[model samples]
Target chain A: MPAAVDVGELVERARRGQPRAIARLLSLVEDGHPQLREIAAALTPHTGHARVIGLTGPPGVGKSTSTSMLVSALRRAGRRVGVLAVDPSSPFSGGALLGDRIRMTEHAVDAGVFIRSMATRGHLGGLSVATPQALRVLDGAGFDDVLIETVGVGQSEIDIVRLADTTVLLLAPGMGDGVQAAKAGVLEVADVFVVNKADRDGADATVRELRQAVAFGHREAGGPPWRQPIVRTVASRGEGAGDVLRALDEHAEWLADSGESRRRRAARAVGEIEAIALHRLRGELAGVGGGRLTELAERVVDRAVDPFTAADELLTNLHTT
Target chain B: MPAAVDVGELVERARRGQPRAIARLLSLVEDGHPQLREIAAALTPHTGHARVIGLTGPPGVGKSTSTSMLVSALRRAGRRVGVLAVDPSSPFSGGALLGDRIRMTEHAVDAGVFIRSMATRGHLGGLSVATPQALRVLDGAGFDDVLIETVGVGQSEIDIVRLADTTVLLLAPGMGDGVQAAKAGVLEVADVFVVNKADRDGADATVRELRQAVAFGHREAGGPPWRQPIVRTVASRGEGAGDVLRALDEHAEWLADSGESRRRRAARAVGEIEAIALHRLRGELAGVGGGRLTELAERVVDRAVDPFTAADELLTNLHTT
Candidate 1:
């Protein structure tokens, strides 16, 4: 049964870029509402147009400031933007400070811009099954760009990279030790590196180091390489914002020319579908208490059955259900 | 289909606490070798014994130093210990700089201690499906304790916390800002907090801040609370090592008393089983590339079907398979 408010009407209004309708649908996603299936089905045809951009970096690295500035740049270009700032909540505690929202206040009144912060509170890693669906909602709502900003350089940020058309890694100067600490982790996900705070003392050195690290990392990976561009920025001063956009445009063009866009999107779709299906299967398995799964796990613990065979047996039963 | 080395023989030797045999079995886990299922099944009876401890902090908080000191203390009590230092490698570039190994070499000649660094290369997060299996191997091999050290505050470390019986969150005096940066991410996993470098000026301040934060986090989470004890240590000098061990023992007793141990282990088992099963399902789907799965994804992308329905159809086919 759908909500008392006709889901059909909401979909139509959301498609026309009505903020209220989009907000309502996203809340549905967040709540895991029963009628989300209907909403997702309704959002189908208008999807896949927005270029999803993921922005991530270590904590205290100005990810929020950069995101806000980028939203301004996109708006200046006459593009409607939707931002999802994913916050990783304290593991012991289920609260998110969300202080980053303060930097984005400039975009609060602009209808052309939509910004929301999502705390990865209950989810093991941030970006639950709801995340991709949320992106689809923004995509379907005629947003030209969807920017995802995840807090910290952890697993959630990496997962976010898989869904983005381009991933921007933000860094700042004089964070030499910090750069050294996270460079290896960030190298894997960065499509474009932004050394923000270029007005700081060691900006040139930081940029140079990053370039070298990127080159070295690419070589080690041993792929036919597309070199990740390192762009310097003073996001506080709004300098180098246009260059970042230009670099994104170039990457977009490259993706189109190589047909990598289609392949990447296809792969992303497959991943999302697999994740959802697995989640459902897990739910099904969990529903049966003191059931076959527990017995099998105990047997595996006791060495009565190999994990693979136990897995096979579980899967066989899964098929019948 | 087993390796020529006679897996059964190795399992017996490892059970007898032959360090070399244990090392060989752990290598099998790391490689994801074909005989892993056999190894896992064989090791099941010997497990449920070793207390797995996870040691993690931000990059430069001296996790290795703290781990080494902890190992020293554990060995002094005549407890056999195994250390799995998880290295988070770049996703794009399959490389890990395992500098942490050098610090633990002081224990190289000590027969009761085993230290190995596992690099998470080509795996999205460093702690792969292999990690739990590796711990099981060490567990089965009669190690009284297995200390797992991860490099940074990321998703892999969080996953590691799931497998650990007690997770030690390491901090240092001058790491105030760094601690603040990672506090929320680390809060969920910390069972005991160790403020290393106690000789430094801000040691007491860091300890004070952590207690306050821990209390705050607990209040916010609103659970049956376990008070995480803060211990100060100058790990390099081996000062306060005994206190750290006391805190761990207290936590261990608390876990057993509360029956949280069983719940945690059961939860861990459920997680491992689910991960393995999901891996198999993803493999099954990938094997049928450009097949029904892709079609379903395309349908979902086109809004021809909701993701849930598409997922259901996929699961149905998976069941039949």
Candidate 2:
């Protein structure tokens, strides 16, 4: 079993603006140890305090650089911020190289900013299994704004929307046909789409294609009725970062005024609860004693009875006996 | 509520070469109505009788044409076959076009061949929520062989390996770099790799690259030693379909000899059972007595206690009262 961390103590330290404590807590959660439940329980009150904005797109879309710029922009507005950068797991080894933090070293010593790198840790999604819990920790720790940067590999990119109140999708020009961006699963989930590397020649056409795609109705109920705004950003120079942050602020305001924020929060709560319940049940099922369950499984497989009826019978027997 | 069909009777009719019954059963399963469980429960015993082969790759790689050719080839071998073609769900409409079936209409009336087109039905991975259950129905109906043709949408393609006893990953010549294949999450899961459209330029290089990728891995004990062979095929012309089938047979034989077949089947059963359990639990939790659970969720969200303890306490209260 992984060593247990004192989640309360970690949260208190993070609340007091201790970067090391915050980083360590984020790492523990990202590793997805079973003990994450204890930490999440301790951190729940701290969520809903920070505005979480998620940055996601295809790999090599300059997500990390864009995130750094966004963080810088938030800091310039005198708001203390937190950054969580998520990387993909290597299929061969199930390990992740958290290389995004290298670009954010400028904030390492800044008292106003905190940056942490995270891995998916066997989770199929781009977001870490414990990401929502970790976000709760950061939120409880009194960060005014939190930025999550995700390595968008495929369907997993969809998970980021659940974790963030606002989602920005980054697209680079000259990468592929502009249509590929529309074909990729990210188009439907993004609230604000950015064409990064606008200095490239095809940027205008990519922006046009993205506008058309967004014009095709994709937003869920309670979001802005208009299409998602397509902005051009040269993130390396920190250009257009402020506009992105302002857009996020406007989205947050809209969510608050339109009562969509509560609906999203409720949906997220239900999703999180369901996920936790499933995880716990898996653990319990794995721990059931002996070859008994296996025998039952074999009997079911042999068609003595169906799995549903057999499962109910097993549970009933366990309860009654 | 959708009307529930008599799936067992449907299966019996389908086995006697009734096309409409087979289509109806497939439609019932695809919609994920409550009746799917009943149909699957009745059909479970009849599965494990068919040799299941999965074909997957990126879109525009001729997967549908390849599937058509494979169905033709299997018929020539005098084997009764069933093809389940999976299509992508439209992000905008949450429905599937199911276009692949149009290509395979020539076999519609062939008694020895049964063809069905399935949509992803909002499943993130290439496989449908009811895919395994549907496969069981076809298998139980006494089809000598079953072919699952996946949507070839990158990561979801990996889900096919779990359901299939033998998996073939197809590639087209001059397709993006071999690294893109690895990044697409296909290289690691394929049992046999095929370079379709072999008449196209760069077929040899694609094959060589795939061979190199396969050679880089040294096999471990439990999993099949990844000796994925790269077969060059003009699938539209049926030039190498026979060779593909022979390779599939050899792999099947290897799996049986090494006891991996039993292990794979066991893993699949456990996976299916887990999915079913979670699905049922979600339904139960949703209907668990109104505002009481909502109150508990709010308290849990407020950090009053850990979710595990909260869940336990709730269950304990329910039992005692």
Model 2, A31-58: lDDT tens per residue?
A: 6656666777667756677888877765
DockQ by candidate, in order: 0.43, 0.24
The digit string of per-residue lDDT tens for model 2 on B97-166 reads 3353356678877988887755433542224256776787688777888988764433344565568888
Model 2 TM-score (2 dp): 0.79
DockQ of 1: 0.43
The TM-score between candidate 1 and the true structure equals: 0.88
Leading candidate by TM-score = 1
Task: Assess every candidate by TM-score.
Answer: 0.88, 0.79
Candidate 2: pairs in clash:
A46-A140, B126-B156
